[model samples]
Target: MAQQTASPDDSNGPESLYILGPFMFLGIVFFIVRIYTRLALSYKLNVSDYTNAVAVLAATITFGLFITAIVHGFGHHSFYITPEDSVIIFKCLYVVLTVGLFAAVFARISLACLCLQFTTSTVPKIILRAQIIFQIASLIATAVVTWIQCRPISAFWEAVPGGECFSPPQSWAFTATGIASDLVCAVIPILVISKLSRSLVERCLVCFLMAMSLFATAAGVLKIIYSYRFDRDPSDALRDMMPLFLWCRMEEVLLIIACEAPFLKSSIERVLRRMGLPVFQQKTKDLNSIHTFPDPRGSQGEAVKKDKGMKIDERKLEACEYTTSEDSTQSDESDGNSTRQQHGEVTDSSQSQPMSTPMDDV
Candidate 1:
C-alpha cells in the first residue's frame, strides 16, 4: 500500500482540526464546572457524576486518536495519501470515532440518571428503563456490525484483505438509531419537567435545564443533515468525513454540557455574581410560603402571631439543592422529609413521598 504524511498545504487537515478544537475546549470547561458544583455545593457524589467523568476520559482518548490520524495523513484527498497511510488512518478512525460515539452514550446515560431524579411513578421508570435498554442495544449493534460490516473483518482498513461487504445500509441504520436515541432522550425530560407541580418560575427553571438536551439534539440533527455529503463520496471518504467528524465531536460536547447543566446551575450563577452581575441571592425562607400561620382561634387566645422573618439556618441552606435560601430546600431522610429538585433549585418537598436513588448503570 502507498503511504504519505499530510502536507502543510492540505487545507482539509487544518479545517478538520479547527472544527473539533472549539468544541473540545468548551466540553472541558463544562466538565470542570460539573465536578466543582457537585463536590462543593451538593457535598455528595452520585452515579451520574461518575459516568460523566468516564465520558471525559473517553473524549480525551478520542482526541489523542484524532491527532494520530492527522499525523498519519487523514484530511488529505485520496490522491495525496499513500496506500499505507490510508490503512493507518482507517484503523485509527475506526477506534477513535467509535470511542466518540460511546462517549456520547455515557453522557446520555448521565442525563437520563439526572432526569430520573424527577420521576414520580412506576410507569415512567419502566418507560425510561426501556428507552435506555433500546438505546444501548442499538448502539452496541451499530458498533459490532460496523466492525464486521465487511467479511474478513480486516477489510475495514486494509484493502489487501479484500472481501465483499454491505456497510452503507448498516451505517445508515446506525445514524438512524443514534438520532432516535437523542430525540427520545431530549423529549422525555421535557415532558417530565412539564408535569412538575411547581410555580411557573420554578417550572421555567427546570425547563431551562431540560432544554440542554433539546439543544444537543439539534446538534445531532445537524450532523445527520450533513452526513449525506460524506456518504455520497466514498472515493473521497477521508476528506469528506472530516466535516462529519466535526459535527460528531460538537454533538458530544453539547451533550456533555447539557448533562452537566442541571448540576452546575448554582455554580454558574455564583460565577456571574462574582463577576458583578445582578443576581438574586437566595436567603431567608419566606415565612409566608412555608406554611400559613395557624388560625388565630386555634391558638386558644395565645394570639397567633407572625414573625416578620426568621434567619435561614446556614446548615439547611447548605444541605439543600444548590440554592442559598428562598430558592432552596434541605431535609433529613431519616425525618421522612422528601426533597424535590427542579434543576438548580432543590427544596424540601412538603409531601413525604419516596424517591429513587440515581441508578448510574442506565
Candidate 2:
C-alpha cells in the first residue's frame, strides 16, 4: 500500500521520485546494451531496434515531465498548492500522459517487428502487420481525443469560465485499449514461437521474454483501478492520483524492457562466461547448418562414402554467434554421433557446416 498523507501539506512527492528514477535509469541501461550487443555481434540494427529506440526516447521525455510535475506540487492536495503551481502540474501531466501513450504503442510495434523476424509464413506475417496498423491507429485516435476532451484545450490544465468538456469515458476507453493490445502482443508470441523447429529450451527462452508484456498489462489494470478511486474522491487529486501516475510509468517502461530483453541474451551469456560462470551448454546442433551422413550398410572394411549433404545458403549462415556458437558443433559432435548410431546411421562430423541458427534475427 502507498503511504498515506496526514495533512494537505504532507505529500508523497519524494517517494514517487525515488521509485521512478531508478526504473528510468535501468531502462536506458538496457537500451544501450541492446545497441552495443548488436554491433558487437556484427549484426546491423533493424526496424525493431529503431522502433524501440523511439519508445525509450519517449519514455525518457515522459520521466522528465513526471519529475517536473512532482516538483510543481503534484502530490499535494489542492489546498496545499498555489493555483499557479497546480496549473503547471496539470500541464506537465497532460504531456506526460500523451507521450507515455506513444511510448507504449511504439514498444508494442517494436516487439511485433521482432516477432516478424522469427516467422516467414504468410498468415502469421499478415497477422503481425495488422497488429502494427491497429496499434498505430489507436495511438493517433487516443492522443487526439485526449487533447480535445475540453473545447478550449487549455481548459484541461486551467480554469476556463465558458469551456465545454467531455466526461471521463475517454480515460476508461484508453485504458481498455491499452490492456487489450498488450494482451494480444503477449499472446502472439506464444502461439507463433511454439511452432518453431528450434530446441525446446531456445523456444521457451524467447517466448518467456515476449510474454513479459503481461507485466505491462497488469500495470494497466492497476492504473484503471486507481483511476476509479481518483474519480470518486477527486478532492485530493494529487494524492489520490499518485498510484495512477506510478502505474502508467510502469506500463510504458516495462513494455520497453520486455522488447529489449531477448536481444540481450547473448551479451548476458558472454558476461557470465567471462566471469567463469556455468551457462547452459548447447547440446543440440544448429538446424540451419548442413550435416552429412555416411551409409552404414556397406561391405565390411570398405571405404566409407558420404551421402549428399544438404545445401545451405551462405547468406543465411552469416548470423550472429548468439543464435548459434561456432564452437557448439565441435562440443556436441559426440552426442550427434551417438544419436545417429541409435538410428542405424553414421554422421560425418568433418563435413559439418559452421554453426548458425535460424533464430539469429531474434
Candidate 3:
C-alpha cells in the first residue's frame, strides 16, 4: 500500500527483484537452447530467429528496469519513497512500457514468420499477410498510446499544474489487443495442423506443441489484469504493478521458446536418447555394402564357389536409417557396435557404390 503524498526523502526494498527470478532464469535458458539448436544443429535459421533474439534482448532490458525500479523504492511501501523517488520510478515505468510493448510485438511477428515456413498455399499465405498487417497496425497503436498517454510528456513522471492526461481505458484496450493477438497466433497453428491428414496421436502432439503459445497468452492477460493497479497510487504504482511488468517480459520470452520448439524435434530426441531414454532408434542399412562380381579374367567355377560360400548376415542397420542428426552416426554410443560390425562385413565383400549420408532437417 502507498503512503498519501509523501516527501522526496528516500527509497527502499528489493522484494520485486526476488519475485522476478525464476521467470528470468527459465526464459534465458530456453532462449539459449533454442538459438543453439537452430544455429548449431538445424543449420538454417530464419527471420523469426533474429526477431526473437531482438525480443529477448528487449525483455532483458525490461528485466533490468524492473530491478532498477525496485532499487528506487518500487517494492517498498509508498511512505519510504519521496516525491523525487516517485519521479524516477515513473521514468523507469515508461521505459518498461515502451520496451515491453516492443518485446511482445516482435515475438508475435516472429511467430507469424514461423507459420510462413510451413505453408506454401495461397490462402494461408494471404492469412499470414493479413496477420502481419494487423501486427503492424497494433504496434503503431500501442506506441501512440504509450508516448502520448500523458500530455506534455514529462507530466508522466512529474505531474504538471496545467497538464492533462488520458485515462487507463485506452491503455487497457491496447493491452487487450496484445493478449488477443497472442491467442490468435497460438490458435492459428493448431487449426492449420488439425486440417492435415494425420493420426489422432500425431495431431494431438502437434496441437499441444502449438498450444504452448497459450502460456504467452495467459501471461499477457495477467499483465493487463495487474496493470490495472497503475492508477492506484503514483508514488507506489511501480511496486504495485510489478506483477504486470514481470508477466509482460515473460510473454515474449515464452513465445520465442514455444515457437521454436517444434523445429527442435530432432535435437530434443537426441537429448532424450543421451539421457538413456529409448527414442528415435534408427535401423540403418549398409549402403556402403559391397557386392562382389566375378572378375572378367577369372574362371566361372571359382566365382561360383566364392558366391556360394559368401552370405551376408541379417544385421539391423537401425543406427543409420532414422538417425536424422548429421553427427548422430558417430556420437551415438549404442550404435557403435552395429556400425563396427557393418563396416567389417563390408570389407569381406567387393566395394559397390560409395555410401551417402541420409538425413532430413525438421
Candidate 4:
C-alpha cells in the first residue's frame, strides 16, 4: 500500500495537547482543593468524597493515556503514522475509552451520593441507587464488549487476515446508558432543591450548579454523533475519530468538575465566613424547613410552639451551608429546648428529647 499524503486540513496531533492540558490541570486542581476542604475544614470524608476521589484517579489516568495516544499519531491521518505507532495509538485509545467510561460512572455516583444526603425520601434513594447499579452493570458489559469488539483482541490494534469487528451500536450501548445516568443525577437534585426552604438566591445557586452536569450529557451526545463519522473512511480512521476522543474527554472532565462544584461552593462559603465577610447564608423560613427528617418524639411541633419568635442563630445558620444540616441541627435543637424549659412549661423528659439526624456532614 502506497502511504497517502495528508490534506492541509488534517490534524497533526500536537495541537490537541493545548486543549486537553488545561482541562486536566483544572480537574486535578479542583480535586485537590475539594480534598483539602474536606480534611482541613470538615475533618471528615464520606462515601461521596471517596467516590469522587476514585473518579479523579480514573480521569487522570485517562488523560495520561490520551497524551500517549497523541504522541502516537492520534489526531493525524492513519497513513501518516508508522505501523508501530498506529498499533500504539490503537491500544492507548482502547484503554482511554474503557477507563474514561469508568470516570464518568464514578463521577455520577459521587454526585448521587451527595444528593442522597439532602433527602431521606425512599423514592429518590431508590432511583439514585437503581441508576448506580445500572451504570456499573452497563459499563462492565461495555468493557467486555470493547475487549472482544475485534476478534483475537490483537486484531484491534494490528491488522490480521480474516479479522472482524463488531458493529458501532454494540460499542455505543454504554454511552447511551451513561447519558441517562447523567440526566438522572442532575435532575434529582432539582427535585430536592424545590422542597428546600432556602431563599431564592440559595435555591437558584444550587439548581444552577447541579444542572451543570447536563453539559457532560451534551458532550456524550456529541461523541455519539461524531462516532458516526468513523464510517466515512476506514483508511482515515485516526483523523476521522479525533472528535470522538475529544468529546469523550470533555464528557469525563465536565462530570468531574460539575460533581465537585457544589462542595467547593460550600467550602468557599465557610472560608468567607471565617474571614468575616458577608457570605450568602442558608436562610430558612421556619424550623420545619431546616431539618429533613421528622422528629421521632414529636418535639418539633413543641419546639416551634415554644419559640414562635425564632432567633436565627448566625453560628448555626452559617455552618448549615450545604443542602444538609448535619453540624448545626443539634446545636439549634439544644438552644430551642433550653428556652422552652426556661419558660416553666414542664413536660415528659423521655418523649420530649430533640431529634438528631445522621447525615454526611458536607
TM-score for each predicted model, relative to the true structure? 0.70, 0.76, 0.68, 0.76
TM-score comparison, 1 vs 4, better candidate: 4
lDDT of each: 0.65, 0.74, 0.64, 0.73
Q: Total clashing residue pairs per candidate? A: 4, 0, 10, 0
Compute the lDDT of residue 63 as modeled in candidate 2: 91
Task: Name the candidate, 2 or 3, with the larger lDDT value.
Answer: 2
What are the per-residue Cα lDDT tens digits for candidate 2 across 1-362?
Answer: 12334453777877987887787787899889889877877568988989999999999999989888888888877667888998899899989988998898899899888877766678878878898998898888888888888889888788899987676576787778778877876787788778765657667877888888898899889888887776523567776788889889988998998888877667655777899976533344433222222432232223222324444343432221122333544556755432233333334453344355535544
In what order do the candidates fall by lDDT, top score first? 2, 4, 1, 3
Question: In candidate 1, what are the lDDT values of residues 1-362, reduced to their tens digit?
Answer: 13334333364767777777787787788788778777775677797788888888888888878878888877777677788898888888778767886888788777767676767677767766776676678668777877776687667677644576564565566666656666666666677766644445445665676667666677777777777655633666787777777777777777787777665556555677899975432223332213211232232222213546444443443333233244224334455544433433222434554332221111
| lDDT: worst 10-residue window of model 3 | 343-352
Which digits, one per residue and each the tens of the lDDT, describe model 4 over residues 1-362? 35555354356466666866787788788888778867875798988889898999999998898888887778887767789998898899888878887898889889888878776789999998888777778778877777787788878788889987766565577778888888888888888876664557666777777778898999989988888666733788887777778888988899998877775666666778899977654442333333212332343433433455776454554333332344444554564532132222322233343343221233
Model 3 C-alpha lDDT versus the unseen true structure: 0.64
Worst 10-residue stretch by lDDT in candidate 2? Answer: 316-325
Candidate 2 clash pair list: none
* Model 4 stretches with alpha carbons more than 4 Å out: 1-6, 9-12, 270-277, 284-336, 340-361
Count: clashes, candidate 4 = 0
User: Total backbone clashes of model 2?
Assistant: 0
- Error at 309, model 4, angstroms: 15
What lDDT does candidate 1 reach at residue 35?
Answer: 82
TM-score of 4: 0.76
